[model samples]
Target: MSDDVTAWLLGDQLNPTLDVLADADRVLLIEAHGFADRRPYHAHKLTLVFSAMRHFRDDLRNRGHDVTYLKRDSFGDALGAFLADRPETTLRLMCPASHGAAERLEALVDEHGGHLDLVENECFLTTPADWREWTGEHEPGRTYRQEHWYRHARRETGILMDGDEPIGGEWNYDEYNQETPPEGWRPPETPRFEPDALTRETHEWVTDRFDTWGTDDLDGFAWPTTRADALDALEDFIERRLPAFGRYQDALVAGEPFLAHSLCSPAINLGLLHPMEAIEAVEAAYAERGVDPGAFDPAGDGTGVGGTGDTTATTLAAFGGDESSADTDTTLPPVPLNAAEGFIRQVLGWREFMRHVYRETMPELARANQLDQARDLPPAYWDGETGMTCLSEAVGHVREYGYAHHIERLMVLSNFALLYGADPAELNEWFHLGFVDAYHWVTTPNVVAMGSFGTDVLSSKPYASSGNYVNRMSDYCSDCPYTVSRTTGEGACPFNALYWDFLTENEEFLRGTGRMGLMYSHVDRKDDEEWEAIRERAATVRERAAAGDL
Candidate 1:
């Protein structure tokens, strides 16, 4: 390591413990405003990034590192000024997850007579080599399933594993993770971190300088901006929410936005907290509680040892007495095998899977449009003007907090867009701008390949569904003005007609897809007159959606 070397850190690469920064005593951080002008990003997203960067800079300087923090209009301007002063300076950076970012940064540095070195990004648990070994000469652009990769990761990391078998004797607990909350149930309170003076100043600056989207109210801002705050948030989630997280991970309720969800994605994705930190926390919590994974019977309904629905009582009784009456000191609630496995699968499985998929399939993946959907996203998405309860609730969450759980993103927001035939690229842009957790690597594969079915690289068929799916997974339909049963005519749910219409419109492509045969069977049972009515209703829904009057 040369004394002349300076580490250039991107906004997302805010972790102080990254290996790339260990040898460098000098650092450069740029807060360029030009990129924010490219899209109308959420005020919270902008504030979180900039405030985190500023705080990281202050922290580095406090540790006796030389820090050059630039607030310029563009990276070029900032680099040009830095390089003009120290021509031929050497810079080091972690390879960014966004495609072509490393090459572009190298070019910019080279243009200014500087040498650049790229290092492995330590934010992720797995490496490019891990992906390569997992794929093992598989053809690119083919479907890569998450389950298989998830199993491989667990085996490699020895997470929740007993010898060669999974702890629960199952690779997936998704079937057990879909239960909605019982009546009168309320989720644990969402943890909030009050903004410090520095964050408040950053928020004010962002509101003043940028034409941002989403709610402008700083009172609703709740993301963690520092490593300490992130660690606290992670601990809070592991203690209070992880127990019930898997049971209702997919459930949607009106006016309840953060139901047992970790809310750690913003921190982890921003590098304030590393992925392993979160994963290990959950694993350690499960281990310290002394819950035996072998006690869970995959053949049972997951309510208890033999489907009796008294998992806590059974486990406690096995230890000596009933949990309520036992003399032993009360520990935190035992983490259900379903909950532990489900949350781990997200970080160790799906999150890693999304990153690698986006890496291998970018540029074309950004432009992929296999479904040929070209309609602009409806006004409901932007303005939250729809009478559909699911759409309104999900959009309202995004507008207020730049956040929504995975189910709301997939089942509510993206599901409706896919049913209505909205363009995948436009939807991806909306996700990128609206979510604090969303980066190019996170949103591209989720919105384009999985959500919009723009490509079959990650999924074989679209995640298209009718109001019935929503009605089953959420309570949104109960209070909704539209009828869940009707497929056409007045007051009929827009999703019902649009879903069938989508299938019929893209039948040539969708009918042949895997797992689509069952849906097409229903499609075949409809009479010509019924399809005609569905088409008419779908057309009316599209018209209303476009006009923002739905």
Candidate 2:
């Protein structure tokens, strides 16, 4: 191996990008056991990464690439061992997704190296350098909104562009995507990919080695672990689910885990699907001759977590197949505008925005606690043992699948935590460990910046909500033990009381923030006795949650 060029690949960097493998003679793929061991990473999350890495290694070898594979304690240990054997071999690396991971690799190179070359990661639509160029005048950590950046990206890339003006005379179609599921319509089933022999063995080994939070049953391991499989999943989503995805993007139904959503995030984040390639495919589908794009009044897509107006009723009425449109043909391409636009916004808009914000906030995001929340994350988050049907269902979904939709993450999980004053950093750590698609770059902006408001500058307002919102958006509250309608007395929903308590507690900090004036006005109207009652009830809820009895 003397003087041989080898690319050191991380789990996420599984693609055969030219920078990593086009001219490289050898590749080094490491399974860092110590990395997974330290975090409360879900069993399935571990399985997905490991299985994908193993498969990518096999694929490269089959294509005549010399590959060195190591299942070792840590990245540091793996690099140490590899370098000890081949001191003269040149080690090249793609820049890692996280700042911490990049720093760790740099430290490894300093300790033991012949020559180390850092290559730019090519999985994302925009590079860090591109991000710098995009936000040239603004300093890092400034309060720049995603809508502003999204508009710029639309013009720059010409995605959904019809000349200088956007298609349908607007940049976004989010108004049509935020709706409740139609009463009789059902969502397409999320396709599942079973594990092969290699995946099975690696999964069993991971299940035995680490005490992760999610389900240990390998039979449920159906995530795409190879590039071919990931592509298949993407195609399946476009054909079977994309038509319905926009209408009910935010709605939640009981016993329906993958309702009209593209479950491609894990694959995309893992480099099995390139961002531009995926976005282009979705756009191509929209432009397909047979499909008619749906349209509504043109407006800019609002901040994902804090969309400007209350679109609850209008969106719900529209997507739920309002009595008139129910009979009309939605089957044919002048207009399926909502589905395509909703997806484009998620992929090209929100996804890119999150990464951009992450690049700016990096090392600081790890320690952010803007809300000054001091309480510990409750046991229910890891164990799926909550009494509230919404929380229980969301937690159980995570335990079984290692993932939940954004609505579940934002509304049920983070909303509850925000109400209870759970530490944002602790919640962020939980997000990092628990999901299959979560990496520091993804989770920091999502969980901290969007979900919990742990760190700010992305979302304009806290996404805190009462049970009323859940009742309207989901079916979970229908079977809940607590009454979704009540805010006081016996059998009141915990979220109702907790929501009021949170507003009262954070009123000082929330006073000047733009979207919170009406909420504070509501808080001010509550009598002292009513405020005391809400606080007292919220304390009970927190106490019960702490003891794992709720």
Candidate 3:
């Protein structure tokens, strides 16, 4: 109650020794009403963040820190309630990182008339000022390249290095990661931690308080909340799951949700584990077991995609999770082991680069119309009632698990959504609402910047698709009611026709793009008879979705 009280310790600032918590007195953690109500965020996401925050508060208490956890609907007015109850307290604050958060706290700071320090949230590797310096010089704005930036971070942080040279004789081994599992390949089962009483209590609180936030069937929800459980989950993945992860990382099989995925994103994002430590542990385990250095070895004796070795590193790298956590100066030695490297590239490289782009250009960036797309999202997106076997099955799984792998998300689900002309915003919202680990900072850049960014914010192209693209990547089409080869009428996969129409309609916006050049040539290769039937059927598919028929 004295004048030295620390004002607001935000939910997101869970990392100790960060600017927000350093040398604080009586840290006040707010469980606010207004911010949670600002948008229709998913109910499970609310549960995830809040439950994690409460567990963190208990941890701070156990560490002997004086903390007051408050839930208030009114901002400045609520300050009076705390002030009256504790007359000797002066507000000392570490300002919030979000624009909405900063603006709200600024009001409280002014009203309280005390010393408030705006500090850096050291959760990210690059600060806002660091990104601004790099971005200020480019024109028409250059997209952030994940590998180039990642290499720079590697050098600066001294990760994966051996005497100023990268370990493994290369900076990357993405070439080896792309081999698909042989037909009838069975992925090892993934680890799932059951929810304890604490998680259940948190779920009940979320349901009662934020009832209208968003909806999902929550019966199968088992995510790690405490630091202890998170560590167990990480160890389980390293020992039982990491080896086979590279091969099936992109694979889609019916009734299987966590094929080779670490499923640790929620824990890492919520500040339960550090990226550097997790990556190092994985590398150490592999080395200890003498995992065949060539297990994921991208350079084959001779065979694979484009005759270019194998490009699978993107799959493995994705697990370091997002870089905007309390990451350390540790990296697994460069594996160049195909799938592993590709996976890491996505998580550490592409993921971090997108965060830089989003922070530097959001609000305006969020509104950009890369493809000039405008259409209502289809009913099946929420209803989970689509006639297509793959889509219906995928959506239903997402509804139940609040999780899906990257390939399932970008290539399968988002691919079909784009083919159907589903509104970009709608898809973005749906993903954010349904996924357990979803956060605006993460999902916005992923959906808006990567999946839908025809302007190439993070991607060089829009990731548009035809059914053939799906068929090659997954076995889903094998059991579906439609054929990938059909271009029109009933029994054709809708993706085949809609793909051409999307390219035809957007030719003016996309023709000059080098990637689109290939798709355009493919479209032109279709004979007159084939093209006419496609036009008619594509039109019907669009009309049906627009009218809420399918």
Which candidate number maximizes TM-score?
Answer: 1
Estimate the TM-score for candidate 1.
0.94
Candidate 1: tens digits of C-alpha lDDT, residues 1-550 = 3357888999998888888888785899998999898878999999999999999999888888899999899888899999898775688888899999889888888888777888888889998888988897646577788998999999999998989998868888788788777655666677889999999999998999899999997889989899889999999888767777877889997778998889999999989999999999998877765354433222233332223533456556555657777433234456677778889999999999999999888788999999899999998888898898989999999999999999999988999999888999999999999999999998999999999999999888889889998899888898899999999998999999999999999999988789999999999999999999999999999999999999
**Cα lDDT of model 3 overall?**
0.65
The parts of candidate 1 lying over 4 Å away from their true place are 1-3, 137-140, 290-329
Worst 10 residues of 1 by lDDT: 297-306
lDDT of 3 at 196: 63
Better of 1 and 2 by TM-score: 1
* Whole-model lDDT, model 2: 0.79
Q: What is the lDDT of every predicted structure here?
A: 0.86, 0.79, 0.65
**Residue 430, candidate 2: how far off, in angstroms?**
1.2
Candidate 3: tens digits of C-alpha lDDT, residues 260-334: 567878876666766655666655654443233345422131322112322233223333333343223212222
Tens digits of lDDT, candidate 2, 1-550? 3557888888888887545687787899988888777766899999899989999999989988899999888777888888898888788888887876777788887787656778887777777777778778657667768898888888889998899988777777777777776454566557779788998898888888887778888766658999999999998777656766777889898888778788999999999988787778778777762133444321212222113333333333444534334322232211266787778888888888888787777778767778888899999997888789999989888888888999999999999988888888888888888888888888887777777787667777899999999998987887899998888776889999999988878878888787898888888788989977888888888899998978
Q: What's each prediction's TM-score? A: 0.94, 0.90, 0.84
